[model samples]
Target: MDAPACAATAAQAASLQALLNTYLREMAPGSAVLADDRSTVEIPLSHIPARLRVRITYFSATGPHRFGPAQILFDGSSTWHSAPPVQVLTLIAQECFTRLNSRDAGQLPEFLRGLFNSNAGIEQNLIRHAGTPEPDGFLAAEQALTFGHWLHPTPKSRDGLTTWQQAAYAPEYAGEFRLTFFAADQSLVTLGSAHQAPADMLRQIPGLDGAFRLRPDEVMIPAHPLQAQMLRLDPQVQALLATGRLRDLGEAGCAFNATSSLRTLYAPGCRWMLKFSVPVRLTNSLRVTKHNELETGVLMARLLKHLDADGPRFRILNDPAYLTLTLPGRSESGFEVIFRENPFAGTDGTGIYNLAALTADPLPGRTALLTRLIQQLAADHGETPADTARLWFEAYLTCMLDPVLDLYDRHGIALEAHQQNSLLDLSTGLPSRGYYRDNQGYFIAQDALPRLNALEPSLTQQPALVYPRAHINERMAYYLVVNQIFAVIRRLGCDGLAPEPDLLLQLRRRLTTAASRLSGAGADFARYLLTAPALSAKANLLTRARNVDELETEAQEGLFLQMPNPIAAAQPQPVQERTDVLT
Candidate 1:
C-alpha cells in the first residue's frame, strides 16, 4: 500500500484497537496493566502469551480516551508495526480456545467477518446521516447511534444481513420499509392482548389495502421482510399455503422505520410499534420472539395496570398484543409479532430519545445530543456545565433510579434497564419522564410470584419468567448500575462535561438516600450496591469467544468478570480526598 493508504489503514486499526481495549478493560481486567499516574495502559496479548503487548495512552479510567496507533511489541522491543483490530481479536480468541481446550475455535472467523461488515455499515450510516436532512425529534435521536455498544466486541455485527438488506433493515442506516403481510385462519392463530386484539389493530390501519381478501374468520398480520422470506421455505408454511390455511398477502400499509432495536419498527402515525421475530443473528442472539415472551407481555401489562391504578412513576411500554400462526408439529411459532404501545404517538413536541442513542457520539463535526442539551440547559440557567450536569444528573436519578428501585424493592420486578432498553423523555434538555421497554427482559422475584399470580393466575405456570431474589438482584446490579448508569457517567467524563469522581459521589449519595427509604430485600440490595467491592460485568468478548447464544443462555450462565466498584471507591472521607484512584 502507498503512504496515504498505509496511514489510513493504521488509523482504522487504531479505532478497532480502542474498541478492543475498552472491551478488555470492562470484561477481562486481568489483561491490562495501568501506570501509577493512570495515563498509560499496556495490554499483553492473551493468545500470543507474552510475545506482544498493546500500549496506548489512557485518560480517565472509565471514560473514552484519545487512543493513538497501538504499538506492536515483539519480545521486549517495538516492531514499529500495528495490528488490525480483527487480527488482535483473532489472536485473543485463539488463546482463549487453546486455554479452554475447546473445539469451537472455528466460529471466531465468522464473528470477525461480522465485525468488519458491521464497521463498514457504521461508516456508511454516518455518511448517510450527515448528508441527509436532519430528521425531527425522536427520529433524529433514534438514528444517531453510528456505533452501537462501546464495550461489545462487535456491537453492530449482523451475520445474516447482506449489504442491501442492511441498508434496508439496519436502524443506524435509517432503513424504512412496509412490513410484509400474512393472512392466517383464526383457528391457526394465537392472539393475546390487554386492549384490542392484534387482528383488530391490523384491520384498522388506514390506507392498507390490496394485500389479500380477509375472510370473516381470518386476520391480517405483519412480518419482517427477511423473516417472511425464511418462513416461505418452511415445510409447515408450505403445507398451510397449499391448504389455504395461510396466505402470503405480500407487503402493504405505511412504511415504518427501523428503531435502534432492528427488529422493532416505528411508524409515527401508528398507535403501536411493531416488534417482529427475525431469525437473523444480531449481536448475541437470534431475534426471535419465544412463546413465553408473547404470554409474558400480556401478563406484565395486566400487572402494571393493576399496580399503577392511579399513575406510575416510570412508564412501561406495554406489549398489549401479539399475533402468530400455529403450525402442526411445531413446538413454538417463530413468526410471532409483539404490538408495543407507542408512547410518542401524537406527541405535543416532547422529545423522547433512546438513552443509548443520546449518549452515543454524533456525526463528525457535531456534538453529542446529550452534551448539546446540557450546554443549552446551562445557558438557560446561567450556570456552568458542571453545575448543570450535577442538576441534570440528580433529576435523572429521581426520574430513573428512584422508580427502578421502587419497583424492585416494593414489587420485586427487576427490569433489564440497560441503556438501549431505557428511554428518556426530555423537557428542556433534562429528563422529565423515563420509559422502560422489552417485555422479554422482565424478571419477577419468586416471592412476588404469588402476588403476580394473584393478578394473573397463568403466571405461576410460566417457570421461565420468575427467579429468586438473589438472581434478580444480580441482574439488577449489572443492567441498571453497571451498564446503564455507569455508561452515562463515562460519557459525561469523556466529553469533559463532568468529572467521573464527582458523578460517582453523586450516584453513591443518591443510592444511599434511596436505600434509607426502602425496606426488606430491596434495602438489602441497595446496601450491597453501596458496599460491594466489585460489581459483575458482562463478558461479551469472552461469551462470544465461547460461541454461546445469549438469548438461550440463563443470566447466571452468561460469563461475568469482577469490575471494581466506582461507588465504593468514590466514597467521601473526613480528610482531603485524592482524585487519582482509578475505578
Candidate 2:
C-alpha cells in the first residue's frame, strides 16, 4: 500500500482498538473468553440477535491491549472474515440497544453517529499531522494528545464544529486563535473574585489588538472564538447589543493556544489562564459553564486558603474569579469565563504536564511519550528500565495519591483528580509535586459540613458542592483509583516499561501501609481498595450509549458501573471487610 493509504488504515485500526478495549472492560467484562496461550480473545455479542463473536490479537489485564483486525463469525456460518470498525461499532451499539431500557434505546443512532465522527476525527489528525514537527514546552504536552481519552468511545467527537473550525481550535491540530471580547454594562454582568478584583486580572491579559480597554463601568468578558459565533445567533444577546447594554468588541487578543481541554486557552507570560463556555459538545456534554459552578469554584478557592498549611506537596490551580452575563429568564448567557491562576506561565512551565496528556497514546509507529521519558531516566541513572519505572510509580503515589487521600481524610473534600484534571511535576525526572485544576469537580462530604461551616459559614450553600459520604466514596473510587491510578498501570504495561502484575503488587503494599496510618474515611477507603472484590468505575461506553450529559446529570444518575478490582485480585490472602466501609 502507498504511504497515505497505509496511514489512513493504521489510524482506523488504532481507533477500533481503543473502542474494543472500552467495550471489553466496561460493557462485557466477564464474557470475553481468553485463549490459554494468551494470544487471542473471543467476545460474544450475546445481547444482539445475530450469533456473532469477535476474535482479537491480544488482551491485557489493564485495559491498553494490542488489537489487530478482528475476525467475526456470522449466524450459522462456518467461515470467518475481518470486519471494519464501523461494522463492529454498529454491532456493539445494537447489543447495547437490546440491553437498554426503551427511553435509553432511542439514543442509539446518535451514539453510533458520534462513534463515526470520533473515528473520522482521529483519522484526520493522523494524516494531517504526519509530517509536522513536534512542538516544545507545556503547550507541547498539551497538544500531544492526538488520540484522546483511552476509554471513551467518542473521545474526539466535535458535534458542533466544522472541519475548518476544528483545525483552528483543536489542540491536537496545534491551533492558536484570538479570543472574542465583549464589553457588557457592569449592571447586567455578574463578577466574582476570591482574591484580586476581577477587573484587575482582566487588565493583565496582554494583547488587546483593537480599541479594547477595561472600563470601570463595564465588565470585559473574554470567550472562546467559537462561542462568539454562536452567541451572535442568540436573541437575548442580539437584544442587548441593540440596546447598547453589551458591545461586541470582536476578536481582540494575542494568539492564545488551546490547552488539552479545548475550552481552556493558554498564552505564555499570561498571569491567568482563561476558560470560556464554548457552544460545542466535547465528548459527553455541551461545554457551557453553569452559574452554580462559578460560585462553587470561588468558594473552594476561599476554603483552600483557610485549610491547614501542613498538607502534602500538592496544589490545586485555583479558579478564584469569573465573569458572566446575568440575563433575565436565562440560566447561562454563554459568556461564562473563569480566571484560573497560571503557575506554568513564561519559562516556568517546562516540565509540568497534564497527566492525561502525558499518558495519551502516541501516533502509529511512534514510541509512547511516557516510555521515552522512562528510558531517558533509566539511561541517565545507569539503572534498568524496570527499576526506574518502579521508583517513578512510588514517587507518583507519594505526590499524587497521598495528597488526595490526606485531603479527603482531613477535610472530607475530594477533588476529581482524574487523568485529565491532574498535573504532574516532572522537573526533577521524578514526580516531586502534583496539581489539580478543575472548578466543577470539588466534592464536600456531608459529614464534614459542621467543620467546614465553622471555617466558612456559607461554604456548603454553594450549589452541588456537597454530597453524601457514600456518594463521595464512590466518586473517589472511580476518579482516583480506577481512572487515574489504573491508567498508570495500563500505560506501564502497554509501553513495555514494567509488568502490570508487579505494579499492582506495589500499589497494594502502598495502600495497605496507608490504611494503617490514615484516619477516618481515608483509612477506610484504603481498606476498601485492598479488600473490595469489585470497585466502581465510570462506564464511558454505556454513558455514551445512553446519551447522558454527565455535567447536567443529577447525583442519582446511572453513570457508573462496577468492575472487578485488580488490586484485590493481586492480594495473596483474602482480607476481611471492615464494618465501617467507605465504599
Candidate 3:
C-alpha cells in the first residue's frame, strides 16, 4: 500500500530505528506527540504550506520499535522527483527525529553537540561538536505536532495562538536533504558571485568537496534549467550566498560566523539587535553564518505586530547586506530570507545605574545610586514621584521571563537567557519593554511532558517544537547567566571596588528566586546592591570606556546620552563609513 516502508537494507533500517528510539526516549522523553504504535510511519510532506510547518499523524509501536509519521511539508508536493532513496530518505524516520527536534529547536538534552557547545566554553568547540551524540532521532514524530497540540505556555494572551508554523519554523535542512542528491565532492561550479563582484571573475568555479551536499529540501523547480534541483535556503541564508560576507565573531573556536552590513543599527523598539555576517566567500556551512538572525527580527516584528513588549521591531532596509540579497534575487535561485542587526547603539552600560555598576570603580557603592539622584532631582523640583531614575537603572535587565515562560508554559523548557542577546531600553527606564533573540539556544520537554501529562489538555499546551529542557538550562547557565551577565559586571566594577568573581553566585540566587510569590521579581535576593559602597569619586552614566574622573568631566549633567568614549572613539569617517563596499 505505502511505498514499501523501511527501504534500506534490513540491518541499516533496524540500526537506524534503534538509534532513533534511544535518542528520543532519552532526550525528548514523554513527548506525547510520539505515536506509540510502530517503529515508523509514512505521510507525504507535500500538501502543506511552503514554510516551516508540519502535519502529524501516527502509528506508534507494537513492533521492534515504535514509529510515527510527522509529514513535514517542505515545499509541499505529492512526488518531488528526487535522488535515490538512500541519498534522500533512507532511515528517513531517524533523520526526521534528530534533525528537526535537535537542530531546529536548537539542541536536545545530553545531546553531545549541546553538551560540548554549552559546557566546553570557547576553547574546545570543535571537539565538542565532534563527539558522538545521543540517539534522539525519534523526535521527528514530535515535529508534526502543531500549535493546537502544544503551543508555548507563557505570555497567555490571544497571541498564544501563534505557533512555529510557516512564518517561523520551516522543516528545511542543508545536509542530506530531500531535494536533489548532490555528491559530496561533486564538481560544483563554485562560482564566486556577489553584488558588485567583478563580472570577468564571476564563474571561475572551484570543486565541491567531502560527501557534503547542499540539499535544500524546500527548493523546487517547475522546470529544471541550468541545475536539476533548487534549494530553498532561509531568505537570510540566501542573502549570505548572495552577498557572501559574514564575520567570524570570536567564540571558543568561532562556533557561528556573523557578518554585518551595517557597522551599527539604532532601532529604538527592536527586541533583538540586528548584526549581519561578514561578506561571505566560502561555500561551506563551517564558514557561513546561520539564517535565524534575520528570521529572529522579521518574525518578531510580524508576529508581535499587535502586542506591546512581546514582539520585535524590524527594518527591511537596503543595508549594505542588501547588495548581496539583491543579486541573489536576480539569480532567481533565492529560497527564503532571514535577518539581524546590532542593538547597542546608545547603551555602553552608562546612562543609568545598575547592579553591575554597584561594584565597579569611582561610582559610589551599593546605594540606590541612580534612584537617589532622581529623588534628589525630583525633590529639587518639589515633584511627587521620582520615576525618572527607576527607568534608567534597569540596564540590560530582561522581561522577567516572558520568552522562557512562553516556551516553558507551552513546550516545557526553553533555554538561552542572557543579557547580551537581550534587548532593553532604559532610555525611558521603568524597565517596561525589551526584545529576546537567539533561537539556537535550548529546549527541553523530557521531564515536564509527564509532569503535565502531554496527552491531556492543560493551560500550558503548545504547538510542538522539540522540548529539550536540560539542554536549555545548560545554555542559561553557560551563555546567559554566567558568561554574558557576569562578564559584563566584572568589566564595570562598582565605585572603587575591584571586580569579584563570586558575583555570579550572588546574581544566580537572585535569578533563581525571581519568580517566587514572596518576591516581586526576587527583590530581597540581590539587595546587597543597595548597600554597595558609593564611588570613591564619580561621573554621569554616559561616561563609558573611560575612567571615573575623565567620565565625570564628560557627563552632560546626570542625564547622560550614550556617546563614544573620548580619545579612543573612532568617529566614522565618511570614507570608512561605507564598510560594505567591495575592494
Candidate 4:
C-alpha cells in the first residue's frame, strides 16, 4: 500500500487561505502586523508562541486575501521555515483553546476530522468538475458551489454521509434523487400551514400521487433520504414502525435536487421547496429544523403579508407550512420539515442565481460567474466591463439593499441577508430583482414591539422573534454589509471588473444618502456603517474551535470580532452634508 501523498495541492492552498483569512479578520487584527505595502504579513501565534510570515498576493480590505505558502519561526529559532495548513490549524486551535479558557478542547478532534473530509471533497470536486461550464437553471447554479464557503475551514465537510451517499445526495455532486417518504398516523403527526394544508400541498407534487399512497387517516412526511436512514435507526422511530403506527413509504417521489443548503430539496415542478432535518453536520451546525423555526416560518409568512413587506423589486420566498412526526420524549423527532415557497419553478427560475453562487471563487483557470456575466453584459451593451459593473452594482443596491433598509426602518425587521440566503434575477445579464429566503433568519427589533404588535397581534406570541435594537444592528452590519455587500465588492475587484475601493465609495455614498432620508433603526444602522472605524464579523474559526452550533446560539452570542471597515476607509470624511442621494 502507498502512503497518502502530503503534497500541497489547490485544495490545501484554498484551505490555508480560508483559515488565514478568518484568523486575520476575527482573531489577529490587533496582534498581527502588516508591511507598509502589504506585500507581506506577520501573524503571532501566541499560544504556540511563534511568529508566522507569508507573502500577500492580494490584500483585500474586505477580508478575502490571497497569500503564498506560510513560514514560521519558533520562539527559540533564528530562521523561518515552511509550514503547512494543517500545522497552521493546530497552532490556531491552540491559541483559541488558550484564549477561550477551555478546560477540555474535545471539539478539536471533530474540527480536524472535518478538515480532512473537506479537503478530500474539494480534491474530488476539482478533479471531476473544475473548468466545466456552469449548467443553466436554478438547480444547476445551486450545485455549482464546488468549493464551498471561502471563509470556512471545513466548507465541504459532512460528518454523517458516506462517499456513496454524498454522490447521491450532495448538491456539489449535482445529485438528483427521489425523496424518502413516510405516512404517519394523524394522531402522531403535527401539520402547521399558513395558507395551504401542508399534506395537501405535498400531494400536489407532480407524480407524487402515483409514487405513493396515503391513507385517509394518515399524513405524509417527506425527508432528505439521508435523514430517512438515520430515523430508521432511532429506537423510538423503530418502535413506531414496528407497531405499524408509521409506515416507511421509502423513496417514492419524483426526482428532487438538493439545493445549496444540503438539506433543502427542490423539484422545479413542485410548488414548494422541502427543507428537512438531516443527521449530518454541515459547517457550524447540525442541520436540524428546530421546532421554533417551523412555527416562525408559518408566523413570518402571515406577518409579511400583514406588513406588505414585499417591495417592488425585492421580496422574500416565504416558508408557509411544515409537517413533522411526534415522537415520545423528543422535542424534535428528526422529521421536522418546512415547505418553502418555490417561485423559481421550471422556466421561471432561469437566470436567477443565489448571490453566493454568483460571487463564489471559480475553479483554477476559470473566470468567476459574476465576472463572466458582467463581461457578457458589457459586450452586449457596447461598454467597458467597469462601467457595466458600476451600473449592475447600483441596480443590485436598489433592488436588495434599499428594500432591506426600508424593512428595518419602517417595521424594524432585520433579515439575515447573507449571500447564500440572497438571490438575484440576472435574466438580462444584470441583477433586476432581489430575493431573500430563510425562515430561521428573521430578527425583529424589540424597540418596535408596540408598532409591530398593532400590525400583527400574533407578534406577542412569538417572543423569540424580537431582539434588542443594538443586537439587530450588529447583525445587520455583518450580514447585510460585511457578508453580502462586501462579497460583491470583493468579487468585482478580484475579477478585474471594477476596483474594490471604487465600489466601497459607491456603497458609502449610498448609505450616506439613505441615512438622511431614513428614520429610526435603519438610519442609525446606515450611519454606523458610514462612520464606524470597525465592523463586527463572525469568527468562523473560533466558532469551530468552541464547537458552537450557530443555530443553537442566540444572535448576539455567536463569536464576533471587529475588523477595519472598508467603507470607512473609502470615504474618511466625517459625516458631511448628504449630497449623494439617488433619485
Which candidate tops lDDT? Answer: 4
List lDDT for all candidates, in order: 0.73, 0.79, 0.26, 0.83
Q: What residue pairs clash in candidate 2, if any at all?
A: none
List the candidates' TM-scores in order.
0.91, 0.93, 0.29, 0.93
Q: List the residue pairs that clash in candidate 4.
A: none
TM-score of decoy 1: 0.91
lDDT of 1 by residue, 87-169 (tens): 66566555545555666546756656766665665656655665654334676667767777757666667777878888888
Predicted structure 3: lDDT: 0.26
For model 3, the superposed segments whose C-alpha errors exceed 4 Å read 1-277, 280-415, 429-432, 439-467, 492-509, 515-583
Write one digit per residue (lDDT tens) for candidate 3, span 1-73: 1112211232222222333333333323333243344333333322233211112222221111322222333
Please write out the lDDT profile of model 2 over residues 1-583, one tens digit for every residue.
7667766786677667767777777766677777787777777776643443455554566566777666677678778777775677677767667656546534777877888898788888888767765434577888877778878878878888999999999988888788888989999989888889887787787866335765678777888889899998999999999998899988876789999889999998688899989888888788888888788778888888899523457988889999999989889888899999898888888888777777777776676777777788888888888778888888899989888888888888887888888888887787878988998788888888889879877685774777887777778888888888888888888777887888898899888888988987778788888888888877887877777787688752337788778898995545342232110
- Candidate 1 vs candidate 4, lDDT winner: 4
lDDT of 4 by residue, 44-123 (tens): 87677688888888888884888887889999889999987778766765665666677774766666777778888877
Worst 10 residues of 2 by lDDT: 574-583
Worst 10 residues of 4 by lDDT: 574-583
Candidate 4: global Cα-lDDT?
0.83
